[model samples]
Target: MSKWSGVLPRMAITQRSTLLLFALAWLGVCSSFTVIKDGASSLYFCKELDCPKFEEKYNSTAYQIRMYETSKWVSTTITGLDYQAATEEAFMKLFEYIEGENDQHVKIPMTVPVINRIQPGLGPVCASNFTVSFFVPFKFQSNTPKPTKKELFINTLGQEKVYVRVYHGFTNQTNFPKEAADLGDVLNSTQTYDKSYYYTAGYDSPFVSHDRHNEIWFIATDK
Candidate 1:
């Protein structure tokens, strides 16, 4: 059996409180997406928060295929030798923007799976670029608050298909690269993807001690 099998029951019980809060607060916005009928908590890794919606296109022992809708996100970039450090710094800046540090001073609801796109350096010792982002809640997609900080901005992702490999535990510079490399190794040879950069996604808060979900995504070039 796959490692993720039978994990959801335990996760559901543990995350009941948080999941309920997310559904009550954000379910209305996803009315057209069948989140209510399907149970939002079961359908997404972001059980306790709103996340970008996607349609499952395929799944296999190696990876899953998903087609995501065009969405908006609040993002910031940080360049450093340490991926963890740069992600943390960028996250804080984007978090501040969502917490009313913007032109409209509007407090936006936080989202799940803070994603980081990594552009590797040419040399071993060179600093890499990490762009950290939070999904913009559907309600605010059309008119997002403008960030006050020059480093923060709103980014719109066009609809696209991606190959996703899901993993467990906290994602840092070390484990993430390993996971990405492993996923790349196992991908079907016939598949085509963007090799220039990949995305790392973390779906749980630091306080969540178990059932944490992380993923690496390779944009499908053929799609």
Candidate 2:
């Protein structure tokens, strides 16, 4: 409320706490998340109202990773960050919402790294550019049963991007055999892909397409 109240000694989240917050926010599916700050040295924030903002100061000062589970009960992975405004208060609400969703148990994960980064790409696509920011990388092994406690990463990367795409059908529905084969030709055709550069998988893009199905992507990043 007051400047003193705003600047109180109440700022910071562990990596796992970050994830718990994420799960609550994503699952609730109300608005967007925001990350903002006064300056690189200032940790205090003034969130917009209903969305998540970008805060470089958090990235520069935080020393751990923050993450949360997207609690959206989607029939599929085709979702997007359809938010309005980004503000610190909005984020506090988001985190609080997540805590409320969790019954305010404060049951955070054990492996949150100090300092966080986040670069949320728009909708439905699984693999995101967490590495692009200070957020910890989200690791979802294809087809593996969801972990009882998945690690939520923090934003460490200072970039955010918005892209769109479209999907057509179920993973094993159409002539995927031929499609995979074609894509393979392109990857191998290049002057030898640095096999170690990434781990390949099936994916679906969320944009516009004649078909309606889960999109797959060959996600790649660095260690």
Candidate 3:
């Protein structure tokens, strides 16, 4: 009888300790910071001095018209898979670079609205490729740190204007195209845009609620 009592106490203590540790880890992941700069189109991950700013150079709220004067950015491309799979894989690689996995051992501030654009090739529709880009902050744009991995590279994007249709909800493979289609219809009826290419922008973390912000941007036709 005494042998059973000794074993039960240690097992119960261990179980409780494991549960406590799991809870703490979950809370820390959920509590990552999000900082929103004034008059900016997207949110920042933390209070980073060198975070990329999403300046709204033009806004026609009356017609749901918003334009972003995006600054030059360093981006890495991921190819050869479906949209969801490619994005997940590319994000990990980019995250590693920003987490001091680069030539300079630099820790770059994370930015919002991770962008993904479809790269069409001469093949079947389902076999189409996609490119994902993370905007590097302006501070590092001049002398950007090179990624340690060969798959990742840095490139600069000059200032460009994009017309966007913003929405609030989770975006997935099933719903992303539907949202893009809806935005296209509106743009066709009310305004002029470069329909040649359109891309999606996501502005929230995976842990965020269903009411998160996302956008579909059509490169605006020059005025």
Best-matching candidate per TM-score: 1
Weakest 10 consecutive residues of candidate 1 by summed lDDT: 31-40
Q: Estimate each model's TM-score.
A: 0.80, 0.23, 0.69
Compared with the true structure, all predictions reach lDDT values of: 0.79, 0.26, 0.62
> Which consecutive 10 residues in model 2 have the weakest lDDT in total?
71-80
User: How many collisions per candidate?
Assistant: 0, 59, 0
Off-target runs (Cα >4 Å) in candidate 1 are: 1-44
* Candidate 2: segments with Cα more than 4 A from true spot: 1-150, 155-167, 172-179, 194-210, 213-216, 219-223
Write down the lDDT that model 2 would get.
Answer: 0.26
Ranking under TM-score, best-scoring first? Answer: 1, 3, 2
Residue-level lDDT of model 2, residues 1-223, one tens digit each, is 6786744444433544654654455444323322222221121121121112232222111121122223111011112232111211133332342233232343221111111112345445533331211111122112212212223222222222211111245333234333434434444233232222221111212121334432222222210
For 1-223, candidate 3 gives per-residue lDDT tens digits of: 7888999999999867754544443344235433334433333332232334444654553224444445545455666646666776666667677768988997776666577776644554545456667777655666788888887777554455566767777777777777777767765455667655577777666656866877777776664
lDDT per residue as tens, model 1, 195-219: 9889999887665569998999999
Q: What is the lDDT of residue 91 in candidate 2?
A: 37
Error of 3 at 160 (Å): 1.9
Candidate 3: segments with Cα more than 4 A from true spot: 1-63, 120-125, 188-190
**Ten consecutive residues with minimal summed lDDT in candidate 3?**
40-49
